[model samples]
Target chain A: MRNSSLIPFRSGGGILMALIVAAMAFLACFALAGALGASKLAGAWTDGLSGAATVRIGAEEGAPEQQLDIVLDILKSTEGVIDAVPLTEDEVAALLEPWFGAAPELSDLPAPAIVAVTIDSANEPDTSIVQARLDGAATGAVYDDHGEWRGRAASAAHAVRSVALGALIVCALAIAAVVILSVRSGLSAQSANIATLRLAGAEDRYVAGLYQTRYFWLGLIGGIVGCILALGAMVSFDALSTVSRALPSLDLSGYWWFLLLGVVVFAVLVCVLAARITVLGTLRRGA
Target chain B: MILFENVGFRYGRGPDVLQGLSFDVPDGAFTFITGASGAGKSSLLRLLYLDDLPSAGKISLFGRDISTLTRDEIAWFRRRIGVVFQDFRLLDHLTAAENVALPLRVAGAREVEYRDNVAEMLQWVGLGGQMHIRPPQLSGGEKQRVAIARAVVASPDIILADEPTGSVDPEMAERIMQLFMEMNRLGKTVVFATHDADLVKRSKKPTIDLKSGTSSGGVAA
Candidate 1:
């Protein structure tokens, strides 16, 4: 009924415990964000590349317009191919501007004409069938489905998500460890008070509840502090135009806040459970 | 009521502090445990309060063998007994009333329910005016009274005290002894342990002299 802690915890160890939990929660926030961001990025990259392809016609593949027309005809006739559109010479130069930086002599060099093709993801046209048909009409035309690049991007994103999740687990464990140590220290420091309470006929649950409640609140408060800090960092990242562009997929949706709340709840649970187990164990041994 | 049969106790792997002892304290009895500094007086009291199990032999409290009691059952049994520690073991940060209410609090009584009882208990101990004073600010005798108030506030069936009046003057000691006597009058068994021979002789109560390794006077009413 009395909510005050019998064990005095206003010591350096308690502060240190809070700080450690805060640090862990802070890192956990970033790790959770990274995992979520990687998942979203993977979906975007895979979807962007999966259902589309390109057709490249080299200069030696006869007149550019004639080769482009042939590739378009083949794609349009193929089942599962949504639409085929050719790129003009100026559009090709614009695509290459990042690499060539506006070279005036670009027209003197031999460049391939390109055609973009969209396909139904659920029923993609067979690349082999389309490539064979194009090769029969124009020998230098090459069909590209972008499947290889998509797979690599998805793999990279998957690796990032896995690492982030692993990091989150490590942070949770670290928080648990810190709480355990802090509770053990509190027990040792207040061993006399504990003995007094025991002699006063206090149940083990009552004694353990004191520490558990204190540490639970400590963890919850620390988690909120860390989350607030993480939110500030995220908001700042969003405000920075260059960084946001580099990490464009980090657009935190509503689910991001929900997941962060989950982290705080998990942190409090870890603290309460750790304190309860430690105190009970120590009391049992003393008894 | 408590019964001890051939109780032998040792601290950890050390030699026995008390050896081959037996005594029975009937309900509502007031018994004094007497000995020299090392005659196992405090050690024997620790046994009665269930702080430590006997290294050998058996102790039964309220007709239950302590050795067979589970941890929870032990706690439940302990709640029926109260202890006034030798050092007055009040928390330095807590006020006199808070210290006295510990037993009630441990029993899960709400403050609103036990608050008046705590104030009344402190008053009974002559510490009503010092209820809000912390242990550090209270005198030795005041702390002793606070301890006694704490011990009996929960209305336990037994009160075990170890040198409760050792830190106070003779006048305070007598007054403290009166508090225990009052508790006994209320049908609670009181076991007092001390090296104060004068106080024991003055009270003329039954005593178990550990130096003799047996009961001296028979159990008292």
Candidate 2:
């Protein structure tokens, strides 16, 4: 519990400081949640892309069924290949529906046969060796591990994560700035109380502790409010997304809640530290 | 013991408010610092409380030179000397008991350890029944008593009262002076600054006349 009577700051700027902390904490929560969400999204994309490969056999290359059979046999014989399955004509048409629409021409266009191959993540087949085997037998077969597109997707996901993390850091700095300003204003407003304390033989650190404790409580309360609001927002958005089927749900893992808790703790620690430093600096400078 | 030798002080870039003041306040003695307004009575008390260092010369409190004390040492040294400001300076938000407990609180004593002592001190100052009242609700004399109680609560070896009775009626001023006198009898040195000559003369204590920058009335010259 705080010894609030020692400083009498409750009447002056307490509410303003708490509200400011709440607003900054609110911003910080969003930044942290965005960063955590982006990190999970990046992991999902990387995993999905890394665990699969595709084998495309042209229709003009010998008998298309023979070409497909040769490619499937080579992939099945390959080490680290978990499963290989050929896509049906209808499945291929469905894959093309996004760009070509429901046109009958997509099926009549002599599309190449595609074999989906799953690989053991611990050990993937060498694409070079697979391509060589296909080139010798299935003439126009193309072995694509999707490494290029996967790299691009991974890079994009990483950039999003980085941007979110940058935003989180910026939010932290902004919160610290607000804390410093509030502490300064508090110091000014409570000058008489401070002078009385100092004259009463209160050490600088002891006086600073009063401010630190005040801000610590403010930070904790405000951070909790902001975090709850952010969590409610995330849950509501997730629920709305489920109903509308537009954006994906937040889908935060269990450990991500611990990360959110860490954000609250971080805000509190930042406020305590900012108040301590500000008070000590101002007291020393005035001294 | 408080000792001053050829001491001088001034605000930044301004003329000296006090100059060449030399006096010794014997331990356990009650000394009055009497002067007109701006004659440096409060300024001298400020110096004694380590609020401002003298612009020139030396002041030794309890045998340690004030100019040579480290910041930490100065703080620790200040714990031995209590100050009562003219305005009372009681935190208006705190009750009379809380205001009286300020010195002990600042000295790091927990409430459990000092609660009884605070109550007793308030009772000693004749505010036993009004302990729960805030300073704003208290009369001027009651507030001054609270301020006095706060000053002496930490058991400081010396009490420096700067016009502590300046805001009260004569009867209340005498009561305040009696409290200081009681403190002095208990072995705490008291240095009181006031412009009220009648009060000073009535007390008949040693006087440091700041107006003429001289020591008289049994204080060491």
Candidate 3:
């Protein structure tokens, strides 16, 4: 009739359990955010590289200007090439400004003339055919489509996402372990009470239900607090981004709340299930 | 109704606490199990309540062998029997009213149905004024009363009490005995295990006296 008959409203061990659950939930939130952000970044990198290519004309015997025109003509004639525009000398200098400081001597350098080509999404250009056509018209020409860079970016993102996923899984197992240990301790602490209830005709399910209900509430409260703290951390980190570029700026604008809600629900379910299993397993063994 | 035939029990590799014991308690019989300390009174009671299985024997209750019942069934059987411990094993966090209503709650009775009944039962045990108080706040005699109230509140067919009045004063002991007697008169079988010889002589009930893991029957008039 009253929860007092089932379990104490507050216990030192129970408080410890709640704190453990909160810590697990907090870590889980970060893991989930990292996985989602990494996946998004990977998608952005892939999309940015998918439709573009670069054609470089080396400075040779003939004027580099004639060579750039020949490379552009080859690319534009290709079936899947959408557009081709040769980079102006000033534009090429701007690209090198990151490595070499801006100086009036930049024009004196024998930089290769480069043309940017946009490929049609519906029809991909056959690089082998374009390369063959360029070889005959313009010797020492090179085609770069950024495939290697895209591959490296995808691999890096995948590794990051994998680590985040692994962290989340470890957090889940840790939460379950905490619940099982806490419940076992609670049972030991309340053995006398449980014996009395058993003698009064309580079934194992009935007894286990009491602990399950208690854990459900404990997990819910802890999970919400953990989520709030995690959100605050994210906001603080975002704010720090204004002062320095070292901190990662998580784009919380998309579906982040949904992920948070999922984490809370998942935490609650883990607690309840863990408590129920521990209680039932102990009772069965005693039986 | 209970039957034990050639029941032998021991804890692990230790000596047998109950050796080849045979006994039967019929329905509606008020029986006392009298024995000195370490005479197997508690062990025998634990066997009767299905808390421990007899190492070697057959135990039957209500025409069904205990060994044949599943765990769930054993729980259901326990609902028809009530047990009161010598230490008044009331949950300390629960109020006297909640403690008394435990059996009913365990039976899955709704609060609306048993709330008033629990209050009335506590009142019958002279604990009406202390219903809201936890066991820690109750006197020894008051705690015993609450224990008794809890045992019989569900109107079980049989009540097993281990030294129900062991911790109370003489006057309170007699009062507790009267409550058990009242339940017996109302057609509930009552069994009590105690070393109290004077109370045994006064009650004049049939008793199974246990000595060194053996039992001898006696009747006092």
Q: Which candidate number has the best lDDT?
A: 3
Displacement of residue A198 (Cα, Å) in model 3 is 2.0
**DockQ ranking, best first:** 3, 1, 2
True contacts kept of 3: 0.62
In model 2, which runs have C-alpha deviations exceeding 4 angstroms?
A1-4, A10-13, A57-115, A125-141, A252-256, B68-72, B196-206, B214-221
- Native contacts present in each candidate (fraction): 0.60, 0.54, 0.62
Better of 2 and 3 by TM-score: 3
Best by DockQ: 3
Tens-digit per-residue lDDT, B1-221, candidate 1:
79988889989998878877878888888999998888888888888777789998899888988888877777778789888888889988778888898888888888998999999998898888988888999988888889989988888999999999899988888888888888888899999999898988988888888783444445522
| Reference-based lDDT, residue A266, model 1 | 84
**How do the candidates rank by lDDT, highest first?**
3, 1, 2
Q: Give a tens-digit lDDT track for model 1, residues A1-287.
A: 23355666786666777788888888999988887777777788888788899989988756887777777888899999999988887999999899998998998878789998989999998889889999899889989998778888889988998899899889888888888887887788888888888878888999999998899888998888888888888877767845546656466667878977988898899899988998899889874
lDDT string for model 3 (A1-287, tens) is 35354667456766787788788889999998888888888889889988998888876645988888778878878899999999898999999899898988988878888898899866878777788888889888888778788899899999999999899889889989998988898888788788788888899888888998889988998898888889999888878976788866787776889988888899999999999999999988983
- How well does candidate 3 score on lDDT at residue B17? 89
TM-score of the second chain in each model?
0.95, 0.95, 0.96
lDDT for A241 (candidate 1) = 43
What's the TM-score of every candidate structure? 0.85, 0.85, 0.86
Decide which is better by lDDT, 1 or 3. Answer: 3
User: Model 2, residue A38: displacement in angstroms?
Assistant: 3.1
Scored against the true structure, residue B18 in model 1 reaches a CA lDDT of 81
Task: List clashing residue pairs in candidate 2.
Answer: none
